[model samples]
Target: MTLSFFDQFMSPVFMGIPLILLALSLPWILLPNPTLRWLSNRFLALQNSAIGNATQQLFSPINPNGHNWAILLIPLLLFLITLNMLGILPYTFTPTTQLSINLAIATPLWLATVILGMRKQPTIALSHILPMGTPNLLIPILIIIETISLFVRPVALAVRMTANLTAGHLLMQLIATAGFVLMSNMPVIALNICIVLFLLSLLEMAVAMIQAYVFVLLLTLYLQENV
Candidate 1:
């Protein structure tokens, strides 16, 4: 068969390990937020104030010595990788391939973009959304178009990821299903089809990572623009 069935279960678990490792490593290697520190202690019943202090020092994002947005990198990468793994697994679904999950990911990034924009230039945040200058006669039309596009950021993000994963996965499924249907009596032809499907699965893996990277890259670029 194309994947030996076991590969379906193994892929997501294998993919998830790096993500979990990244999450676990965050406390030791990154700087802490006092709010998160306190929350972690309270939730986990951590009693050692010295340890807490040490943990906080290690994990604090606001710390002078820590990398800016470094802590966030863990979750951001994990989320996308998890999404990709989800797409690869059989029977187990890829929620990221759905608009809902994409929206969940995209909306927050878009909000962060807005919040950062407002923080940097509150007075002109909304107005500065469009390019600096334009003809007076076209200003209103341009603003309307810009505003519409701004509102569609989440939609665009959602569609991009969902469509990519869905298309790739469906192509694989359809190809494999076709092989099975055509080669019900011919073992050799069936085997060849399985090989094609296996190759397609590999292609799907690449596509999954690419789509996730694109979404995250776009989010980063939007944030950079506002900053």
Candidate 2:
């Protein structure tokens, strides 16, 4: 059997069970569970420190009402970061690379923000449909455009994530394949390619982490507008 370049994105199965479930759940189990000891492990301390700093930077601008979303945002940020980093390992599938999964996650959260705004401040929410001091003729056009843009937020989020990961994964695969094929015939070039591949892998790791933070950060921004 031959392997397709895109096959990496597909969910694998073993003994009739999809491994996507494992991919989704494995990250949570790997996280450090709190213990009853007075002094925590250094790793746990580092983790807590990182979380605290991230939360401060992310939620500092929002009012107290929006601060309550830390529970939702922090876990999600960690989950995405783990999933993305895991996918970097050999033979692992990234759930975020799938648009359906991303849309499933992004749409409801985005809709919730909109709903919160409408529920908490209907005037402010409705007012978003049109800016103040608009010309009579432009009001309808502005409203239509804004309304369409409002609906497209989730799609934009899903596509941004899907595209970034998909493109990076594909590119990395292409480079690795070229290196493998050229190893015997063009060893010098292949050696250089290997060095490049190592560098690119490091960059991809950073991209993976940054994209996850950006995803949660955008959600927090949406929540801020609402709360």
Candidate 3:
């Protein structure tokens, strides 16, 4: 079916995200795993047992919400896909690639780690972070430096993703838009540019997946550090 330029733009926002999310998550959804299976059986066992029986599995054999992470994926995956597609849409920028949005997501994640660390070990947290190996005089200065470095994690994460996505997107736009602009006067040059744009689009698909993986990996590392 024929689609207007506006429709093409909206297609990524509306259709592309849902489809891509579903495709990427099918492995987790469809694949049978021990976690879900054990929970399912526990669920059935509870229904069959009496009121006195230990059926409520909040912090025991089963989690409060069995396969809840899987459920959460439905939204997280959707959001990520939508963000990726946002840049692909015409006359629009990817919010995910914006420093503000990236910092919004990253800052909280890092802060959560710090808070948890503090809660787990009130005095030890500071000593553990700063350590006893350093000189006494340097303690205050080191802490100040370390504190700034810790907070800079989100800023780094935000800039890294935003810059990468923006650079790649600008490259794509330059090729595609420039090709279209040249079509009137320089037919041969326009044709060559179109080929370059086509290649760039294909490369972009790979980049989209790489960026998603990198983001998730960084998230995991941050969680591990604090938790």
Output the lDDT of residue 11, model 1.
22
lDDT per residue for candidate 2 within 4-66, as digits (tens), equals 999999999999999898999999998998788989999999899999999999999887898
lDDT of 1 by residue, 100-147 (tens): 657977898788877877787676667655566687888889989988
Instruction: Count the clashes in each prediction.
Output: 6, 0, 0
User: Which 10 successive residues of model 1 have the least lDDT summed?
Assistant: 4-13
Candidate 2 C-alpha error for residue 103, in Å = 0.7
Q: TM-score: which candidate is best?
A: 2
- Candidate 3 collision pairs: none
- Rank by TM-score (best first): 2, 1, 3
Off by over 4 Å in 1: 1-67, 123-128
Candidate 2 worst ten-residue window by lDDT: 218-227
Could you tell me the lDDT of residue 143 within candidate 1?
85
Candidate 1: residue pairs that collide: 30-58, 30-59, 31-59, 31-60, 32-59, 32-60
2 versus 3: better lDDT goes to:
2
